[model samples]
Target: MPHDQTTGIPPLKHALTRLLLILAIIAALPAAAESAGKPEAAPDIDIRTAQREFRLSSLRGNVIYLDFWASWCTPCRESFPWMNRMEQKYSARGFKIIAINLDEDRSRAEVFLKKYPARFTIGFDAAGKSAEIFDVRGMPSSYLIDRQGKLITRHIGFRQKDTAGLESAIRSALNRQESK
Candidate 1:
């Protein structure tokens, strides 16, 4: 093994490390390209929940609220009850709330679920592939998707004051879907 005298490390080892990094970036491209910001089609999510496998495309004709959350996030804990209410209130009207948990440890998410049960669909994404596709930038990021699967709006954090506006957006999307 030829040593790089300047760094005192083998040249072959450094080249292999760089090659691995490049390969990882290349592998991530397809997932990043899957979804973008608002006014575009929502990314397809094929994630497994404890109950069952969830697919975003399966609910194509319904207005969707896609939320990215983690078990340890306080705002995420606050949002669950509100989301449950929304799901119960609007599910019959072709509205669906799909909350994806991004906790790296599945056990933590399970514990959270035990404390605050979700009425709507809950999907686990321990690897964060779905979150990456959605370009989630915060602990609790929410995206509203119209019936046609287009991303309508996004909310970054959960606050009691924000509920009314978020509900309004959900209602508006549902209404718009009804009209069309």
Candidate 2:
């Protein structure tokens, strides 16, 4: 094994350095392939709302507020009214809110619905397959999907104060589509 005496680094150390460089390059590939600040195409999940078959892909031309919520999440209630206002404000302009309930039991979600009762579409995903696709990190995770079906941004949790930012993103997304 030839060693670099001047540098005091052995041949094995050189090999390890090369291995580390390869690992680092491999680790960065996925993030590199992903376009920075570009919205990802959402998974078109087969889901049923209380009143309709909510085909996610059918909303290509419309801005989407795709939210994941569970009945037990308290912040979810706070998001409902804001979503309602948003829907009312933007629905005519080709915007819609789709709240996916990740409750294990539909009855619990139904009960919560009776209380917070959203004016927007509510879809049920008892198996949480949709959540897995979205890579939801929190109880009330949300994705702001643009009119072209690309994700604009995501919100991890909800609060009354979060509405301003959320609304701004929504407006920006809506207007961005209108121009195109």
User: Candidate 1 lDDT, tens digit per residue, 74-110?
Assistant: 9998999999999999999999888999989989998
Question: Alpha carbon lDDT of residue 153, candidate 2?
Answer: 90
What's the count of clashing pairs in each model shown? 0, 0
Local distance difference test, candidate 2: 0.89
Q: What tens digits encode model 2's per-residue C-alpha lDDT throughout 1-180?
A: 678888768989987998999999999988887877566787787768877785788888999999999999999988898899999999999999999999999999999999987999899999999999889999899998887778789899998888999999999888888998
Candidate 1's clash total is: 0
So what's the TM-score on candidate 2? 0.80
RMSD for each model, in Å, please? 10.9, 4.5
Clash-forming residue pairs, model 2: none
Off by over 4 Å in 1: 1-38
Off by over 4 Å in 2: 1-34
Single out the weakest 10-residue window by summed lDDT for candidate 1. Answer: 30-39
Q: For model 1, give the RMSD to the true fold.
A: 10.9
